[model samples]
Target chain A: MSDVSAHPSLSGYEVPIDSWTQPFWDATATRKLVLPRCADCDRFRWPPGPFCPGCHSQRVEWVPAGDGQIYSFTIITKGDGDQHQVFVPALIEFPEAGGLRLVAAIVETPLAAVRIGARVELSWSHAANATVPVFKIVTL
Target chain B: MKHESAIAGVGATPYYFRGQSAPQTLYEMICKAILAAVEDAGLTIRDVDGLAFYSMGFDSGLIAESLGIPELTFASTVSGTGGGSAGVLDLAAMAVETGRAKTVICVGACQQLQIRYGTAFSHMPVTPEKAWERAAGLTGPGQVFALIARRHMHTYGTRREAFAEVVISSRLYAATRESAIRRRPLSIDEYMAAPMLADPLCRLDFTLETDGAVAFVVTSGERARDLKRRPVYIAASAHGGTCEWGRAFHWLNMPDPIFTTAGSEPIAARLYAAAGIGPKEIDVALIYDHFSPLVIMQLEDYGFCHRGEGGAFVESGAIRINGSIPVNPHGGHLSEAYIIGMTHIREAVEQLRGEAVNQIEGAQFALVTGGPAPIPMSGAILRN
Candidate 1:
């Protein structure tokens, strides 16, 4: 029952929560950004799967995600219609998370200011069902 | 089974802009294309025993029943979208060579009226993999591939000028053909003026949203000799992806090499090995042109040039009609029509038969590729 209607900008975007992804949405609801880390291999699995891709380890633990840098970014100028607002989506790479790159929208920053390797800090936005994790560029 | 099977005929419907094919349903277009292909081969629907398709398969039962297919021996479809376009041809070839079926037909059709491919991913049930993408406002393929395009530009200095060459070159070829949708000559100025949909990707960078269908007939080499057209022998076919290319455009976690590549290196190696010829021997190339930059990336992945040299390769005017290797002579998906990657195959067969509208003189071989999308991205080599 994950909803994005609360965020008017993401009006039609809906993220359905299933058993495998329930824990992830639950953590985000508390305004915490957590990723699934393999207890046996000490590696992180993105999208929160049941087992590790490297070691096939089922032992998983929720760990706090640290700050990340922009690996790639895109400015979406054309969308569904002319009334659609332009937005920037970036792939934020976390060094501490074993080279994990997560998809996050770059908000609160000028579009032209976004670049690869720029540091980004974790932030949250309210959805109808969960808190979606977003990122803001770190100026300092 | 290299060279054991060959393409006997190819056919397609008039490509129309989205919603322009209103009165004609997708199934009707598919049926018409199949009939045209059968007629082109001098055969009837009763002669067809197997059907090979990609994506959703289009309900082969309904197709067989409606088309009055006397008996259906084999029916199968490759997974994923256009990436399996050439792979489906391989399936038909295998069925022919193994004595499972004598003649097989491969088909693909697209109608964007009910569902649009641009924002298709957003409408799907949010799987674990798509949850983050949906939240990040990454809704379409053009927006998603922009990330990869930007990375290529950052790491290798691949410029928009090279992408413009790909679009302009394809349009230039399309302008000469009567069956093509965009038959107007495109200049670099027009490409430069095109509105940017996704950063580094302009309107011309995207493949057209078309309503059309394409079909081709396949049979064993021995049986093809008695057919109506010149036999374009299937020399080799390969389809698969590397481990790092998982979910591809959806997941941006790939490391260096595969990250910047079209993920066609593995497919290319297998194709050349099985065909017993390298890229230089190919007279014409029908590389998939879903996006302008991908054409450059594939030119590298397929060994047309050294890695990261694709930008320079296109800028040198090598992919034009009189260049080293003419690519997409039928205008490809960029300027012709987007029936997935089937149009590339139709163009390949036409080139090998020496019957293409913009025919490459003495075209002995043609290379056709499937999507750079996901695993099992396929390619096939056909020789006259």
Candidate 2:
């Protein structure tokens, strides 16, 4: 069963855990980022399909992601009545991983401070029955 | 074959917002629409021998059983998923032309508000997307289109205000008609001030959580001559999708989709050729407006304007009611109820029959398109 915990600002937080996804979640619990890399094309396939989207290779493995960059983002303002909270939800891109983009929330960062081409590193946030991937803008 | 079948009648339930409307189940809304279509066609339930639909709204067999459509010889559930609204009419027409069924009615029904519509696309449990896609807060339709809109902006330098024309035009049209749920005249300031559901997309860009159902009846041109209303001839109908459009909605890594080509683009040439008319000859158009950028995409895809110039074409007032060509005089999904794309077909039928509330001047050809990219799309050309 999943339980609820509050973040600084974000709504609709539910994480999924299953066989193909358990390792990713387990790694997240330990604070690591991993993705499916194709054996034939040596490119990472996102959303973890059985066959590699690149070269139709079923031989794929979950490997660590070096890093990602913010592709595009949206500022979500959700709540009831007068009480509202704002957070940035973004699609982060891994260049060397064959265009595998991760849809994660940007936490512990001000919405105005986030940039379109901002570089971000992955961090984990525990919620309910799973660990969710959260991102923070990388400072040089 | 071009004029083998025609639309005999169209019907719809009074559209309402989630809580503002009467309490009726999704099935009841569909039944109301289907029965209304049968009555509008001036035919009894016994004459209805065919049924077609998409998105698995409610079982066709059970729907027929409920409607007393006895001995259904033709029943087709289209394969494009929800993007097959235009194709449903084609399938119904196919049934009539092939003599599989004498009278066929295509129906589409959905009550997103009741179904917790938010969870359907976003939460892809029992799949790999559960871990990567939905869990990351990218579940809403607004998110997918936000990505597409941003790409369009990046590629063509399309301004965010370029969508103002579409929003304003649709609301203005809606205000003139009583059936429109979103009748308040929308101003540019209001549109700009609307809260963001997804980046590049404000609340105005998204369609309302509509509760209703729509259906249209199709039969042979010869048989349609004896129906209740003027026969809306189906000059050409076609539908298909891109090469790699999967049933599951994950297209982040795919090469260049949505912005350039559309689900409706693949079948545009064939439909226009079959209709024996060009886009310039079309009196009105009812392109899908589930999102603002898609309306722009369809305008480009259907040859109304050059590629990547959709933003400018709409902003220049070319699509206003009295402009060179009017679009979605019924307000479309943007201001109108989001009955999937079924309402677009219903509006096209009414416009061609010269019965629209915001009727065009003696429209001859009407172009109606169905769902947007990442899914197989469909479209049809109708003549009065």
Candidate 3:
């Protein structure tokens, strides 16, 4: 994983943390990325669901999330009329997690530095009520 | 699902820019559209027995009471956003085919006075799913789809000009219609000059935020024959997508091919099978154009051309008003008004009935698609 310096403070915003996703949010406080893994099927679920789509099992555990590859991305030159702020949101795919991908911001990276196949490791962005898992570019 | 169900009439209130239709409430627009559709079908409002709607359908009981629809028998709504626009027709058709109702009204309405669609997602009360997206500063459909557009360019070496062609083609078609909000065609240079909302998607690429209502009258083929005008036969109608495309742009978990594509290939296949026709048989295509790149992607998904060849196909002027496929000849959501995917259906009905402004000579078949959304993205085929 990249250093915290590469992760920007996104503290002003608040992300709704529900019981189903509370564990994921709790793990993020320590800058640790955890995803729900089906205890029976051993498949990881993104967005932390109640049951497995494949095995339809309710038994699950939160395991440390692995690094991902940037599947695709976009740079927002402007958002909400905030002309000065630029956002780089990318779809990061975790191959080990049953190929489940998550939408995260590519923080502290120059717009020119992001590429489709770049490898990315988990990072943290602090929201008002929870710590959100973001990502930073890393060497393959 | 077959020629048993047909669209007897189509109608819409004037398309107005966001907030321009304020004096008229959403329900009022719905009433206007329903009444207009009833009259267009040469049937009195009393003849309508059922009401069908999609995308946050308003209360049917209220509408039935207000419009004084006599003896409402069937009232239902298809789920999902604009993705269910065309799917709602399936509900109406099913009701008519099953003899549950002789006449059904399929409607969609929007009034952007308070809630604007352009920045729609930003105002959403964050749920667990939205929490992940909102935290990443990903708001609005354009921002999310931009990632897919970027992947498409990366995967197929698609150029921005193809998207430009999509927009210009719609504008060219809209130029001939006084109903279109954007009638002036744009040059490639002008499109390139437009401000970027999201990288790879300029202002011109997104659909216009309009306030209006569009409605259609559907009935059994036997009854349609006795109506005022020619009936646009519902040869086929389909909704739903592959499991991989679940949640679509919002989740972005779909694998390669499915990720970059429009995610409509499966729906298109089912539609073709149900219609007993192929892509070549389609004379006009009213594809949903919420974003320009999706239009290109859908062209490929619908088999207008081979996969990954949509950019080139569109660039060759094959989607123009006089082109082989003649896509969006009534100006799609891009140049026409974006009443969700309702306008596209209206265009399909008009084209098939030989009443479209940019009419394709002897057009026999028309294809209309709902917006490229999550599971339940839909499409339909109509024949004259």
Candidate 4:
């Protein structure tokens, strides 16, 4: 992976970190993609919301998602090279985590083989004091 | 719902870069379009009581203040579908049916061309999940839609030639449209040779970003009867979303995820049912073409063709200006400019009014749609 400082410039403004998403970043540092799974509904949620989208349950807990399947992905061939270095992004759905779908990059597969539904395992890269959780193909 | 509203007026700022001579503020664009639309309707700004705009547009209070409208009655902002233009129909329906407000103005504007350029994912709210997605460099619309294009090719026997057909047809329509940013006609060979943005998706397959604003003023059919222009009635409007966001253990499990059944099966059914017309009755269409493949996908979803036959149907010259169904007569986002599909709606209204730069003769009905992915799909049917 390229250096964080070497990344391409972003548009508009960059948001500062808050407490709700802090744990998510901490888990990413360990290469684990964690989501707030509503203990009541047993479903992983997004936007780090206080309540679940399914049942609007307030009781939510951080859950570990070790593996997932590639729900959808795109291999960007154009753009800043450092930013598009064989970049393969996918929506990984974690069934164990109550079907929480998280967007991440698949680092281990060739671009051509990265199709919809490819099984991927969690991986991590440290960046700017944060561990960014990525995914890699689950090799047989 | 009384089911009686008409788009009385429409307006826009000539497309240009955000900071290029024209005003850069969304408020300025909204005012320009709204004033023009109101004037076109032979009405004054005072006639507008309610307002609906894209969530990404300028603030409602700011716009109302700028327009100097006192005691505004209704206001709303909607987003997520990228089809922010469809808000015109929704707001119009509210104004006419529920009597929320008599005259409603709907506006969509983006200064993206003036703003720093970045991937679509960059615009996603900066949460840990988004940050993780961005850190891995999976941050753009091109990449997301490319996956869809590839999948369509794999599952439906779609070919690059079929994809090229869309580019060629859109360009053909755009060539006659002076407002189109790309006036040059594109051939199949040229489209095929265009540089790839992603595997199977070429540069020509993507829409261009141009700075501009489009607006519409909608009111009750009774009010429209007194307007300057022939009022285009809103026959039907619908939006849908689906959450495969986390569903199955496999990637294909999320295949064909649709957010709005209105833009999908239900919307198509209801639109035809409400309009008392079918896809065959559509004289002109302004399907969003953020990506070429999506145009085909929406064509199928809207019942222009059967499942998995959109590619083949488009290849048959049926989407040409003089063909069975004229689509994107204003060049669409592919050739004209990408204003988050707002311009497509404007083009639909213009075609229905026989005022399009590339006007389709006697076009009575037009169908316009929003984006395909990331959920929240919306659509509208306009008739003169």
- Candidate 4: chain B TM-score against the reference chain B: 0.91
In model 1 chain B, the worst 10-residue window by lDDT is: B120-129
Ranking by DockQ: 3, 1, 2, 4
TM-score per candidate, in order? 0.95, 0.89, 0.95, 0.83
Candidate 4, which segments miss by more than 4 Å at Cα? Answer: A1-72, A78-84, A92-102, A108-122, A137-140, B1-3, B17-25, B64-67, B79-81, B116-120, B123-125, B240-263, B373-375
TM-score for chain B in model 3: 0.98
Chain B: TM-scores of all predictions: 0.98, 0.94, 0.98, 0.91
lDDT of 2: 0.77
Deviation in angstroms for B374 in model 4?
A: 4.5
Model 4: residue B272 alpha-carbon error in angstroms: 3.3
Give candidate 3 misplaced runs (Cα > 4 Å): A1-12, A79-83, B1-3
Q: Please give, for residues A1-140, the per-residue lDDT of candidate 1 as tens digits.
A: 11111222564456677776788889888888777889998988876777798899888888887879998988775445545556778899888888888988888676656889999887887655678888888887
Q: What TM value does model 1 have?
A: 0.95
In candidate 2, chain A reaches a TM of 0.79
Candidate 4 local lDDT, residue B241: 45
lDDT of 1 by residue, B63-131 (tens): 998899999898988887778888988889888988889989999999888777877776677776678
lDDT of 1: 0.86
Error of 3 at A92 (Å): 1.4
Q: Which ten residues in a row have the lowest lDDT in candidate 1 chain A?
A: A1-10
What is the lDDT, from 0 to 100, of the residue B382 in candidate 1?
A: 93
lDDT (tens digit, per residue) of candidate 4 on B201-225: 7889888777777878888887787
